[model samples]
Target: MSTNPRGPNAIDRHVGSRVRLRRQLLNMSQEKLGEELGVTFQQVQKYERGANRIGAGRLWTLARVLDVPVSFFYEGVSETLNQPGFAEGDQTPIIDDFIQSADGVQLAQAFARIRDSKVRRRILELVRTLAAEEAEAQAAESEQA
Candidate 1:
């Protein structure tokens, strides 16, 4: 149960996103993760969705099961969360969601296997050029409409 009426806290969501990201990167299913944690897959889903708060003990277990340090979950947490008027719509969560997706994980794994820095740089440049072209095409289409 979230303490705030507004759903899961930002920190909880961030932690959940990290959990999902790591789990996906490892190519582990939620069912497998839950089996290792001795919990139901539904419970694992809740943890990943931030619907349920993970206690310290459970978090420690998660770290053990996931083979990540407990601090990994907090790696990219914003320093300005306590500041007034902090914007909630950050790109990190979007990127996290993508990284947790099947296609994104596949792409990331393939990219990681590329040991040549020049090849990696060329692939990145190709991707950027494609993205810029897509964006320009969309803008032109919108103007035409």
Candidate 2:
């Protein structure tokens, strides 16, 4: 059930997810971001979860602190919205969903800091192999059960 006529919408969640993604990509903790925004970490959590809507002024301030243009928050959002002139993009509306997660963000940030292309490629292969092995193991276990 929703709370009100104008409660947090899908756009709000998308924006918050972007905020969390950007903050994670910067390796910034929620507490650190909150300190920068002069808010408590809990409030930051709320904003990140889209439980509370971000106001325009706060969004402007967040843009500066997050070192991203205000438009960054709206990047994939318009794809899900059916507003006039807001359609037709190759961007997947849910693309940010994974990177917005704690694990996904940490993996991406760590992988991004790798300067050696060879090492990066090796790591990618290793991860692929591990994932494949895990999937096979899960399938085998299911069969056994």
* Lowest summed lDDT window (length 10), candidate 1: 79-88
The reply for model 1, stretches above 4 Å from the true place, is: 1-7, 79-94
Q: Report the CA-based lDDT of candidate 2 relative to the real structure.
A: 0.86
What tens digits encode model 2's per-residue C-alpha lDDT throughout 30-56? 999999999999999999888889999
lDDT of 1 by residue, 1-145 (tens): 5466756677776788788888988889999999999999998888888888888999999999889999998877773134445566656556766776779889988999999999999999999999999999999999999
Give per-model TM-scores. 0.80, 0.77
The residue ranges of model 2 lying beyond 4 angstroms of the native Cα positions read 1-3, 79-95
* Count of clashing residue pairs in every prediction: 0, 0
lDDT of each: 0.83, 0.86
Model 2 poorest 10 in a row by lDDT: 86-95
